[model samples]
Target: MQRFAITHAALFTVDPQDRVIPDGTVLVEDGRIVAVGPAESIEIPADTVVIDSGGKRAVLPGLVDAHSHSSLMRGVTENMPLMEWLPYYQLEHRALTEEDAYHSARLCYLEALKGGTTCVMDMFRFMDRCADAAGELGLRVNLAPYVADQPGKDFFSTREENKRLIRTHHGSQSGRIQVWMGLEHLFYCSEDAYRDAVRCQQDYGVRIHTHACEQREEEDAVLKHFGRRSIGMLDHYGLLGEKTLLAHCVWLDDDEIKRLADTGTSIAHCPISNAKLASGVARTPDMLAAGINLGLGTDGPVCNNSLDLFEEMKFASLIQKATRLDARALPADQVLRMATIGGAKALGLDGEIGSIEIGKKADLVMLDLGAPNLTPHEVTHAGGNLLWNLVFAARGSNVTHVWVDGRCLIEEGRSTQVDEGHVVATAQTCGLSLYERCRALDHLRVDMI
Candidate 1:
């Protein structure tokens, strides 16, 4: 049954007791979420398909960036850091093609599906044209093809091409895509490619994304080439457990934050690409008081020039209260549960798509609570301030609708699948022909800092 529902909204059920519900509703069917609360208690049946949103709309749970990268070299590599921006991003990722990685994954999955972000984790380079541009723009991806095996970063992606992109796009589109198992740091691999990417994450049960201790000279060049430090050389090659997933540990220590909360390893905290490449801040409230599992990333629209997870949940809570000057560091309901269910438990996909509850998978988004900076949308059971105006005055142009498994690929504000002005004029003509092939391979470094 294809059902639907969504009624007079205002929800924000980042559940497990974080419920917010005003007039709420929900429902959905074949795409999961059997029903949520309010609207005078559930029951909107009689052959579904409703969508009322008259409570001015707020909804929630969709976000989840968890680390990204499907580059188009935004604003042309300004200033620089992270080792002088990796040779101008490996010479514009070696002048990409495969139709410029399918129009840079259709301009970063159409700016992460018009910014309400319904799941990402991208890690790049021709990801089977970023899984056919997230199966032609519906979002919920994982891909992760940037695998590298050292020796001058052998132009990334390998480990038998990340096991043929996990046997050709793991759980393909109907499951909204996922592939994982990628590595591009800890000195770009080799300890037999980190034991063959932790034996390709136990031969494809999937999971293992990379980049750790994101700076402090990449943990002092992985502690002078493997005397251990990028999380103790990724826990000395067994690649520290719970199906791995790092990405800017931002130079940890406190025994690498208790070895990533003792191997339940997960962290994608890319606070504005580590404060726009000066690369330093992530100890996300001491890795969430050492229990770890933090999430919220906006790491690449070419170093976050923008794939707005509501400006990465308002700079992941004003850079943890301006670097822990502590006006209640990382609050706003724990940075909106680290951008929706701790970014679907940092990409393991939290029992199938972060919160809204019921049986899950309905994805969601909504927003536009009569815009004007979300008017005075109340419902934090009345004390209001609507989760601090959706983590400090929401954006992504107040989203205005977007669904995932239940379909509505963005509504009141465009895209019911494609043609967002011919995907931003074909990513501005393949980002000006990969910026004149990185200024004819001199890697266009317009020295400015």
Candidate 2:
């Protein structure tokens, strides 16, 4: 319940207009923003903590990771196809124990928070422990325990187990930690599992998260088996809705795009992961044009190898431009929205935490504008267009501080919750030990060709 008055910041409000206020002031009290605007317009209380941005610093809304997985296998799954890559890395990583998941989740949150991400939509196995880790670290997390009943692909929890988890952690930690229904993929789940996804949402009023049209082969397989494309198939099962968050709609067609828009479904585009796997570029321009809410994701650390949304934001713009042969296909402003407001909208958390405004949760990030990478050029009439510098040049290392719900989780580029040294050490040990245990399996033992 700390009160603070943040002032003298080069603020990027990221509202509907993406207003850049030269010197702005934000008043935060009890984990919510009381006022936000030019310093001349707001009154400051003498007793509040005054965080003055004396040096070159920019304040913006905390970045959101629309989709991610808490796994410690970064740099291990390289150049594998989408289908093969899943079982090869993810299934093998599922051997994680409660402690392993805890450490892994801690590492994930550590990196993401340091990189200025305050919220994450994570689909991982053994997520009760994952929820605990997120709650402990103070990052807003949406947990969807992976659920699938197919024989060979059954690497998820049961409906009953997920319900128990929902009861245990859904609204815990002041609603900062939540649970949703997750089907790993339409291909991985049985029809019964699909029905159960609806039942979970209907019974518990939770969101449904799953993977959709990620690769051509996946779409082909779905068409052969279900006589419909990805969106249409999911729609048939009543799985596509306002709360449905589908990841990697890379191979969708025109009609499917319309279906997504019509169903009020959202997309979490993982540009780096798709490009790394040689998966085709998603129809992002069309999806946006069709009124679909699209957000950015890092997929899994093992696939993209990093959770830096700054990196994801750059790739999200460049890939669309290259694919469409239109340099203006995806602009910096749109990409920034995808990482911030659009991400909140996609998760249905928009009313609470996306942009900087009065009454919203005080989730914010501050960047060192003096960083060498952000210097020289890109200056507009008003100082510099930070949206351009942030997306094009600034790296995660440029993040100076981060706050979620008015709590400063990271300050001066260091995590305050867990010791980075210990978290890194524990993750390294867990990863090595987990890799050793899984090496006996044929999937882990096989070398990718």
Candidate 3:
């Protein structure tokens, strides 16, 4: 059996009450946490491999990124209208081979692990290859192929492609990979496609994920096509439920919010992607008040330029405060919950991965609080809340080490599963090849990177 232990760190359990143990120890064996408590209380087991934290690190439940796309589109999709951005950005994805998809997923997992994210829900194409790459890299992932039936936007081979993907790869890799049904969007999918998606979920017992109310033109097109608002149409078509995870939900009124709440649908709020696409501010404060489950997301690498949940955390709070003209719009604790527990709940993995509870999988991140920006955060006894520092000050760079499934995938700022230089160089080479093959140089805000 395998064994691991980390001691002498500030443990933010992020449990129900947001418990923080200043001098804590966590013991693991065979991929499960055996004990977690104040350091003096928990005995170190024999033959355990101990990880040193230098007494100034904070041990947190690994950050959960609820929505992402494994794409090489960073810096190329900026400053375009949402409608224009889709074809310019996503269409070129068709040019990638299975090898390209593997490299893309590898790079995405590499960046996410470095940024302290242990779990991700990504929707894209070539999902089998992506699943294999994630399995090899040791990050827990939920993947699906983008399914749509629009005249020019069929991202999957057939309407039943996600079904095939689920049968072949879902729940594979010792449960590290879970597959879901991904609809491109309500606007892009026909009524038959939507019905089929619901049927697929019922048959396979997998969750349904898709975009909704994201683009500025999306609501108008949805109304024109379906004779109702976006959320209303989802409700009418029997698509709203606890098993549904919607990506954007940026444009919702009171009734639509009620519809979502009534159906128990979860939302993945992408603050950076909304701003980058000019998709406008979501009714986030209202959504939270309505008792909806909202989680933070980075969308895609090209759109946000980074898969840093720390960046998403800051924006998730700051945007709400600014949009509502209330300095108290979203408090520090609530935003922190959105990044951790909220994401777990959204992805329906809460029982196993969200908090630093004993009997849970050992997915954790250790951040060096001694870092410059995280300084003045010595201790809560000194009147500083590191929880707030985590939201407003911490960056992805502060992550010193990461553990997923009790395995050390990122150690001291480097990936253990991949050669960092080779991964970066390969992604760079693939990006250029994709651009050239897709003839995508015309869709740029800057002439050059």
Candidate 4:
């Protein structure tokens, strides 16, 4: 019967009404939010540990990274498009040993926690290690071990490995970690593999995750191979549905968008990665208008270079506005929702997490409003600029505390579960060794020595 109370904070409940309680309190019991309302309205029990915020902390649902990858390639690859980048990325995957996989997940998850991402949907290789790291670190996660069956795609996790991961890790970690069916990509799979993915979904009650329409050339490539466009081919294979999450629909037609909306398929939009790879800007406004369930994703560490949802939120809005030439497109409030509840919806976990509401899981992030960048938040009154500053101006450095399942994993901007210094030191050694082992140092932008 663990119990706690967080009081005198500005609560951004991204609920059905979009409620923002200026001075609120939330009560937690057994990892669930038992009560939430204005500070004056809630009664704190004597047995509960109280966290008084002094009315200078802004609390919101922990940001959901709808798409991510556990990798050691941050700052290791650059200026390569999706197709051209695959070989180099595959090289690293081939060189990665099991120990390297664990360290990579540690580094990536540490970064994610420091940046206020409490839940993540990660699709990458050697994901059993990733699952172990997530369970130890206390973040909610969905692991999708990258799976493929085509001859050239043997570098990815096989279907057998995917099944093993599902059986071993799904619903593990006290229901905090879930394993999904991860298909590497539409082009990377044979019809047999697609059918097997569908079978995994039906048999295990898990969802399918894959990249689709990421590059401008993908439409033609998928059409040439399957005799149908990317979305159409997915539909033909019975892949588009509520239980499927597609990453980066950057080149979809209006009809395809309609098909996605009709099927209730979700999309994870990784704007920074898309721009980094020079993939064309996705028609985000069009997708939103078509009622698609879309959310923000930071992609892999190498592609995004960071997992901070704050940066992703700003870019997610600005890119849409700039590309659509409409200043009102993807405004601050909507982008914030996309990072929070919308992301949970995309991952099919909205009911449990994503908002500071009664009965929801007590997964929350608290930012110090006293930070120089957040100085003028003044969230105690209406017309406060807190929400606007949060999306447009605040950085991950402002995050002071992070809680998942009523347990504080990061307090006062430092982790309580693992030694950050050790994680960084080990990751540096592992990364350099991996690059050297693969003879990839020569491929770096500058000479090593």
Cα RMSD, each candidate? 18.6, 2.2, 3.2, 3.2
lDDT (Cα, 0-100) at 335 in candidate 1: 85
TM-score of each: 0.36, 0.96, 0.95, 0.96
**Regions of model 3 farther than 4 Å from truth:** 155-157, 381-383, 440-449
Tell me how candidate 1 scores on lDDT.
0.81
Off by over 4 Å in 2: 377-383, 443-449
At residue 62, candidate 3 shows an lDDT of 90
Angstrom error at residue 61, model 4: 0.3
With a 3 Å backbone cut-off (N, CA, C), the pairs that clash in candidate 2 are none
Which regions of candidate 4 are displaced past 4 Å? 380-383, 440-449
Q: Give the whole-model CA lDDT for all candidates, comma-separated.
A: 0.81, 0.85, 0.84, 0.88
Please report the TM-score between candidate 4 and the true structure: 0.96
Across 365-426, the per-residue lDDT of candidate 3 in tens digits comes to: 99989998998785552224787898899999999899988999888999888789998999
lDDT per residue as tens, model 1, 322-410: 77788888878888888889889878888888889999888888978777887866775642787788888888878977889888888
Q: After best superposition, candidate 1 residue 156: deviation in angstroms? A: 14
Task: Determine the backbone clash count of candidate 1.
Answer: 0
Pick the winner on lDDT between candidates 1 and 4.
4
Q: What would the TM-score be for candidate 1 when compared with the true structure?
A: 0.36
Highest TM-score: give the candidate number. Answer: 4
TM-score order of candidates, best first? 4, 2, 3, 1
Q: List the residue pairs that clash in candidate 3.
A: 73-302, 74-302
